[model samples]
Target: MMIYTPKAGNAPNDAFLFNVKERSDRLMNYFLMVYFVLGLIFALFYGTWLIAVLVGSLSLIAYYSTKLALPNSTMYQYVLSAVFGIFMAQFIYQMHGMFEMHFFAFIGGVLLITYQKWRLQIPMVIVVILHHALFSYLQNSGMDKIYFSQLYNFDVRTFVIHVTLASVLFYICGLWAYQLKKYNELHLSQTLQMAELQKESLLLLQREQYNEERSTILESIGDAFFAVDKDWVVTYWNQMAEKILSKPKSQMLNSNFWDNFDNSTNSISYQKYKKAVETNQSVHFQDYYEPLDNWYDVSAYPSEKGLSVYFKDITERKRTELLLIESEKKYSDLFQLSPLPKWVFDVETLRFLDVNTAAIEHYGYTKEEFMGMTIRDIRPVEEVPKLEADLAKQLNKDELTKRSNFWHKKKNGELIEVDVQSRDLVYKSKKARLIIANDITEKQRYIKAIEEQNDRLREISWIQSHIVRAPLARILGLVPLIENPAESLDEKEKMLEYMLQSARDLDDVIKNITEKTTITQNFV
Candidate 1:
């Protein structure tokens, strides 16, 4: 911050005094020059070369002295006034007491009053009195040639009257000078006071403007704000605070805080406020308010004068948090109580994160053992590379679920085929997968057995359809020939023998069919 210091010349009454001194010095110099000229002219007329030189020298000295002494010397003006008085006296004496020249004495005395220094007039008055007394005595005491004035019979009465009149004029001039000096001093003092007051007023205006801007910023903020004095009276309540509280500032300011809010003494917000004030520290918390059916995030700051509070309505955020918690609970229940053998494993490390009861029982591993093992531990060594490739592909896809068949090893070292259905998920803030394993070992065995039985049954059906028909057709042809009436004895004997051979072939075909059926049954 910059500090303001009034200039030296700007000090009270000094400017006026300094200006007067400058003007007086210039005026006195001019008067001295004129007096010197007049004195020299008079001396020349009277043929007094020495007096002319003396007057010229005195004039030069007085002018230079006043010019140099001004501003620094207070007595310079009075000294100049005395010098002018002496000049007048010398001029009158040189002119043999010309009364007109005596009048110059009065003029010089009156002119010195312009300096506003009554003391200067005193020196000029003294010079005039002494000049009058001495010159008049000389003229009256056998020095009549030295005329003091136009009235040559220079009596004591005339001298007294002249001196008295001069004294009265000097007195009046001195009084006026004194009063003028006093007036100047008073005016300068008042001016200085007014200047000081103006400076103070300007400072006050700046302070007020600063405060107004601060208040504007506070009012424009998004958060609710209020302040209370030590007496618990509301001192400041901003627009946001008004909206949050559903009350206007006009109704809140200057009112007791507790009275207006009607909060219970045991309320969390009330307790927080009390704690902040008692400890002279800042307090922050979130709490639900029953009156407004809302949640608020509040902060209170305490100072010597009072406490300031800032708060925000967080009811919507609170409700969202509650809903999320409920959703998480439901998900946890589903994962834990599932009938399928379900487990979760970290995607990056492939370490088991969690396993359901079904997963533990189906895998034949304790929960603790499962937690300590990775997904690769449950897969056959030959299938690990396939599992890795599948996982690598899964990493590139955001698919919810993936299905694959793999050989899995149980805790008893038994290898079984499993159909694994897995989905991506985040568990405990880490990328992971949830898996449900369907054991297909028994079902696969049953399916293989049924396939073998179907193959055997198909072979038996082909045999019965082609081989049995060939044998039966031969037997039928031979028996018909043997039963015919037109046949001779040799032909009948040959036909009967052929019929017996055909019947034997049919019996052999029947035996083959029975053996195939027996084999088909054994396969089933």
Candidate 2:
């Protein structure tokens, strides 16, 4: 395998310190210019050509000393530049005391303490301190270089004081550098550890995001989903499962599945799930009712460690089944006890599935013996040829219902007139027909009886209105002829009037009877 590396110029983090580097370079350049100006000022202050030459030479060295481009140079390069600049300043001050070199050395030592080694910076500090003390002693000692023998004193105390002060200054510089180095090392280690912790934290956040996304998808599905351990404790419960079972996941999950629950029904689903786990086999269950309102089809499959269960509500399907059963029961009872004959037949096969009690009686067959028989069996042989096409038409249509008059032959070969009403229906998962038949063998006799009663009432009404009333009318018309033929003819007139009143009463009775007969005919 080969590796690819980004070119340095285009690498993004490679320019991380570019602005800092630029600023650092500009500041260093400014410092160089300041060094040159300071050297020029010191040379001017010397007020002599040779001294000015010496000062200018030192100034040039300080200005150009750090102008090197080394990519891998350590911070020690900065320390070295500061040392050289300080030495140049020392030379300038030596040539002319217009500026204090001792104070400049102090500033250089303070800067060197930031980067230089403790042991190394100590010796430099001692040299600067010794130079300071020697200068002071020389100033106070004498006006000229008088001979030591003539001086009568070596000034041992003065020498001792100068050495002691230098030693103390070196010791302080060593201690300062050592403490700074230790502090830098400790700070660097802590910073690296903090960066590593941040990386680990970011990885954990990504893992959590992935898990949350996965869980959201699972909960959005409509099926109730759950998982359990080998011991049958609930491990996971999805949102649908919570909604269907009316149980909160916080209270139910991780608990024993058979524990006391808030379910409306103590669901056998939980029990069946446990059984599937114990048997280590998958189980499929159908048409199980949780309550009057809840029905489910469920399956549990064994997993390596436990079981996974899935189920969906089938309440609508179960409700439809119950409605069909109730409808069938209502019609079955009516057919069995009804006075009129009735029969149920399979439409496709045209075979009888069942018959009511009256149908069996009228057809002269037992209930069990009549089942599985065909409609043609009880029909007249002459009618069978024409019946095939009619039955076919009935079966072919989506819904076929009609009333017809047909001839039926009894088991003993007696012919009967039957009024039949039939409709297509489904029976026991098969297409069938429901038939109700009324035997009309005595229908004409009943009609004749009603007609006779109606005719007699009409005749009586005619006799009362015409025969009886006409005679009464004739007697009233002859009332004037018989009136005064005898003494007291008024008495005969009263007797004729009573006969006319009797005739009127008979006519009223006839009219009432005729009206009642019409109503009876309508009811029949």
Candidate 3:
């Protein structure tokens, strides 16, 4: 690429020239006032105040009129040159050709230098020479009224010397003015050239910084990255790419993108990348490389010159996904084949999402019937309100719910006791639960029978303690009477007979109690 570089030179937009021009403009506004004041001051002693006013007024009118008419032009500048010379003439005439008065014309030349233009001095120099030559001739020709010099003898050599000196002074001032203007333009050009250089340097610096940052990002990223040109040439290959692809930079860079690799199986990948550049679009997709048994997430971005493709190894992610899919399949098989009366239902609608074979058999519902039914369908009508209230309560998704003795109606309309426990789960992507219901009808019947046996055993225990005690006490009292030594034979025999009757009655009571105890034991 070609670049334009600027060099320092003296040019028109010079700072010094602007300042000089400003001084010149200010001098134009008021420099003539100096002549008028001088003229008035000299007029005080000479009695020529009318000549001073007349000449001063005429010069002012001409200078100001030309300045107004040609504001943007330099015509007023030339007029000032002529007008300042006229003031010098007035000074000489007022001084009556005093030799020192000629110096005023040189001062006029110096003042003109403020304009920064040597040409403004031309008319001033011409006017001064003309006024001197004409007045000198008139004074020497016996015109005593004309004052050309203080000495009566004004020779040609003297006049020539004075003219030469005045010319040298004006020339020096004009040359100085030209040099100042030249150097001012030179300084301006250098400043502009420096500015251009700085701009170019800044652009180069920014471009270099951007390249560094881009290199750092490409190398530091976790994924592999590489770039290819429009002709399928390798351009940039980051460190990650070298490592992941197991290729060195020397082997990959500047090499044909296809030639560097086995293209037999990767033609699909190559085509994908080419299409992106051809279409001028970016594409992102994953492709499996069969040779490496690897999967890559590819992102290709197209630019005017080429394509930048990034490759990420996603083989592990793909494998994990496959494992998860297999695991879900196994889980689904377990859900369908489990022997327990298990089911899954949606929590929001209380709808049955799935049912095991056991559930369909136990609940007496067909698979199609269960599919259309909500959890409320199997619940006893009376318990529906409780179910709603339970659901209405703010329930944590992680909470376990157990309805140990809830009633469920089978298809035959028989309400059976059930021990139901459920937990939250997501089934088929729905907010649902897997529930296990245990029928407890036989258990309740057994518990009731046990309670009845307990009641009968309690009555048997009462009979043994209160009624059996009477017979045992009578027998004990009679045995002591029969053993007494002081008893007569007849009395003893009567006591024995009474004891026998008591014993017989006691035996009957014992037998009756034994039969009832046997009955109670048989019942248990």
Candidate 4:
């Protein structure tokens, strides 16, 4: 999907100008061999194979020796190009100055173009010109071994034109080479630039990916989260943050943090956030924003570019916490103000955890004294074993409240009977008991007195039933006998006397019974 175009698309690389360059250096070896073979083929028809072989073999030996000596150098390419011109010259001589054979010089110049350096054509051009001028002069001066051209009418005027044309052709080839070299430089510059751009593009892609992942994580979190830069500009506001703070993302992001939430400028979170940036360190704290009427748990971290802040609305939690505090206060008041004696004790240690005012006064112990004493301290010594046994049993009991009777020893060592009411409860985070002590000493005493009085009444009722009944029966019998007199007037008089004695006896018994009844009532 990417296209790379050279800066100078019309022009080619200029390694052909110089000796073979970077990637083309090895190709020069093949080029050198081709040129030498051409020379030998020319020599075969000219009867100068010996000259061709000697020159060609010597050139190859020289180039290879230099290459082996200095492998890093490209100077060998130029040497080979110049030698190519010589090969062309030999071909011209073998053909006896054939004008068509002279085109080989230009061909050699063009072939050298692969190296992309214009300067590589210089040596070859010079060699061809010198060979032409020297051979032509010699042949014109009547030298038998030299060959210039087949044209016998070839004068100085024609010779000058001929050499001039060849020179121009070589210059043109070199010029093209120079232009190619410039194109290569531009192409290299462009290529390097493109590579650099690709590197930056890759880095940008990674940054965007990281931002996306961070945004996703922020959105997924449970806490209300928002972020601000060093300039206090809001950079991010998550869904939870918008819902909790009553500000949507569109209203928050990119806005100045202070300006958007201006009403909370006086909040502690604002000051702490600024402090975090100034110190260039992370800070964590909780703050109550008055305007929002909410609390926040915040953490701010400082970075080289800016500050990053994460915060959550803690309003609901704060509200619950305040309600819990109030509830505890209400219960504390109830416990302290209750009229009945009360105390709270730790179940595991049997130690008092708290005691009401009434408990303090009734138990004859100061609040401080009670706090230091355990439940065992307030019970009679004889009751301690029983108390332990009862507590052990209560450990497995799940009842909310229990009522029982116990004897408690006051601080002054006076013992009082009490009706104890206790319940299982959690107090100040500890499993404990809340107890109410209802004193019943006087009530028990009154109950015992009533039972004694009832016993006396039962005894009086028995006396009336058995003894007084006997006297009444005797009187009735004597009265009937006296009323039945016929020949018994005297007898009636005797019976009456007996009846009077019996009545006296009955009155005496009644008096005894009355006395006994009076004594019993007094006792009651």
Candidate 5:
């Protein structure tokens, strides 16, 4: 969520005019300084102290004016200042009689034209030419006596020398200005070109940054994103797209996506993307997958040149859905084929809602008949109270044990024993009991038979002890009776001893049987 703003905008002004102003300011300062020094030399040598003072005052004013006007002023202002400076220099050279006027005029004329004032030099040149011609004529016509009488006036040659020198300075300064102006224009042109190039570079950088930001945003998402041309060539591939598709941008870019990837064949993404490109319309589809059990929800949006696609992985969702479908099928099969009777009851109403096939057979009721019955309705009237108490206990407890039995009556009016297990568990988001019961009728009969057989065995043991012991007691008495005094005394004694031992053995057998019957009754 961070935003970066680039400092890439047009400059405040054009490059050309800025350079012109800068060059003009520099030239003006130089001219003012030269003018000041040359004016001082002239005043000292020619004794023209007042003229030097005037020149000094002008130079000072020009210096300050140049500084103040530099930012806003044009080349025309510097040309005017250079002209004034040339005049002062002319006055100085003229006092020496050197005749440097032509040279100075030529320089000034060239400079002025260079400063972009090519037209202004004509009038100044004509004035200087006329003054020089008149001075030569005056000297030729004997104006020398006038110079001696005129207190402040010079001779004809001196006037000619001064005018010529001033003209030369004018042309020289003009030429220099002209050259400088040309150079400045060229430099400004180069600078403007460079600025344009810089501007272009900045624009490119901004475009790159914008693309990078868009890429970062797209890649940061968990979904896969890509774009393709009408030709099915890959153009854009985001980071998530790379990871999900298992291909990098370098390998995928410009490649035919449909041809390169095996999953593309018959896949919803490929179909939608291709359709968008073919028809130039947006397309969306879900439940797309690779062979690896991965599912995707895909969308393709048509653009001017191609299509943009977004893909979301739904593999886990699809797997869960499949598992639920299989589970439902298994439950349905089990409901129809299960051997035990099972009933679904509503916790709130305690009414029977659904029953399996075995429940109908065991309960001797039709599916419709069972639908109208509740747990209380199915129980025998005599057992209703006990069943209610057991049900309440089951509701309070977490689980139900199968040992708790319910007496259910058949439609034939015969009561049957059923081992029932019921627990309070959530069914369809409501508290309900899943009751699974099995008919334990045959098992109860076998248990009763076993108990009767055990009783008969105990009766037989009692008879063996009492009835058989009576006969053995009689035989032992007979043995004592059979012992005769006519026989040896040892024989009579032995027979009596054997009778005592037989009676003791019979008593021990009776005690063992009685103890066993007591232990068996305690277990029961």
Candidate 6:
């Protein structure tokens, strides 16, 4: 029911005005053409070709003049009104005051209303009054040539009455035209306002829909969210906020923010919120709330309206992080206190990242020096190629652990063999391997000595079993021959000589055992 008023100088209304002017111009041209045709018909009825030609020429001029004038100009409307009046007057003169021709003046007045300019009708009214009074007076004063009617006597009273009546009728037509113009203008203004109102209503509806969708999205998020105005009055509280804060939205809305959460004033959460609002910036932090006995990751965003806060419970995550840190500390202690040499090195560059106390003592290098050096620096020069190949194989393998026996050089230039146990893991967020080296140089040397001792022992046992036994068996054979009484003295002497040979063989075996034992002792 409201009457919508457009803004001043609205461009759409300006365009509407131009359109109305153009349409009025076209209508005026059409009416002038019709009026010219009517003038022609009247001339033909009266056999006045001059009048018809004059009227046609004037009509053409008026039509083109109006067309040439700017549509926005009121001058064209006035010119058009005058042209219509002149054409009608010419038709009336040719018809000699015919009532039908008189009616043409009223029609012209009505047609002028299409221009929607009330002042334009004044020209037509003036032309009608002048035409009727002057022509009637001339005809009554015996001016026969200009007489338009011969059927009635031309008396002064009669002429006055006729002119007066015609004047009143013309005035009435002019009044109607004026009222019509006013109505058209009002209608055009109202139509333009109605269209603008409809467009604004549609825009408002779309804005409301967008806000509703945004609200739904905010409500659906898992994080607790709330908004406060510049006055610190709560304006919005999502469902998650209600659940996390243990308060309903009905109690939160329009409530003072500090009144609801008084304990938070001295806390980091409140400080961050205040800072964000004061600086008009976004703040993100994690803090523990004593009231809830929980940690929260909070973010505050400031806007012209005020501040909005989003928070989520992070107590579980914090506890897990603490446990992980403790576990890493225990593992670090074990690694550093281990008796065997241990180190961590980058997988890509093979540079040592960390080393235990045992590694520093065994490798004869300071921890700082080890950190600046690569794993290859500790290996003997001759084994570097094999080390590179093994490293390449390890890179291609998905296995977590690898073992290899590598000869390493110490800081004193002493080469020691080591059994390396390497396990792959992430160290300081980088791909790296942890190496535990078991120094096996002494063990390998002892193993070799034991092997040599076993060989010597086997050789001694073989000599005692084969060579010693053969000599003893000969001796036993000779003793039996020498002890026999039935045998002759020469036979006994020969047996004694055989016994002496066997004894010599046994002595040589004993000397061989003594010499081998001495050599084995020296080797040991």
RMSD (CA, angstroms), candidate 6: 14.4
lDDT of 1 by residue, 156-209 (tens): 898898889988988888888899999988887888789889999999999999
TM-score per model over all chains: 0.46, 0.40, 0.45, 0.46, 0.35, 0.53
Q: How close to the true structure is residue 280 of candidate 3, measured as C-alpha lDDT? A: 93
lDDT of each: 0.84, 0.66, 0.82, 0.80, 0.68, 0.82
The residue ranges of model 3 lying beyond 4 angstroms of the native Cα positions read 1-16, 27-30, 57-72, 141-148, 153-155, 183-210, 217-235, 238-251, 256-524
Tens digits of per-residue lDDT, candidate 6, 264-337, equal 89999888888998888899999998877889899999999999899988999999999999999998999999
Clash count per candidate: 0, 0, 3, 14, 33, 0
- Predicted structure 6: lDDT: 0.82
Candidate 3 least-lDDT 10 residues: 1-10
Which segments of model 6 are wrong by more than 4 Å? 1-206, 395-401, 456-516
Q: Candidate 5: lDDT over CA atoms?
A: 0.68
C-alpha RMSD values across all candidates: 19.4, 23.3, 15.8, 21.0, 21.0, 14.4
- Record all residue pairs in model 3 with backbone atoms less than 3 Å apart, i.e. clashing: 10-185, 10-186, 11-185
Best-fitting candidate, scored by lDDT = 1
Task: Flag regions of model 5 displaced more than 4 Å.
Answer: 1-17, 20-24, 59-70, 75-82, 85-98, 101-225, 230-312, 317-524
- Which is the better candidate, 5 or 6, if ranked by TM-score? 6
lDDT for position 188 in model 3: 70
- Per-residue lDDT over 1-524 for candidate 5, one digit per residue giving the tens place of the 0 to 100 score: 11212234423233444554466557756765766666667667767667666757765775476545563444345445445534534553335434443444454455445335444565556645554555445545666522111224456677667666666666665566567667766876788799889999999999999999988889888889998887878999988887776789899999998777865677666566667777878877885554546778788899887888898888888889899889878976886788999888887788787788998888788989887888788878989999778777666665454347788887777788998876666666677777788888989997996797698677767779676677487656767456555777777777767777777776776776777676666655
Give the range of the ten consecutive residues with the poorest summed lDDT in model 2: 145-154
Q: Global lDDT for candidate 2?
A: 0.66
The per-residue C-alpha lDDT of model 3 at residue 463 equals: 68
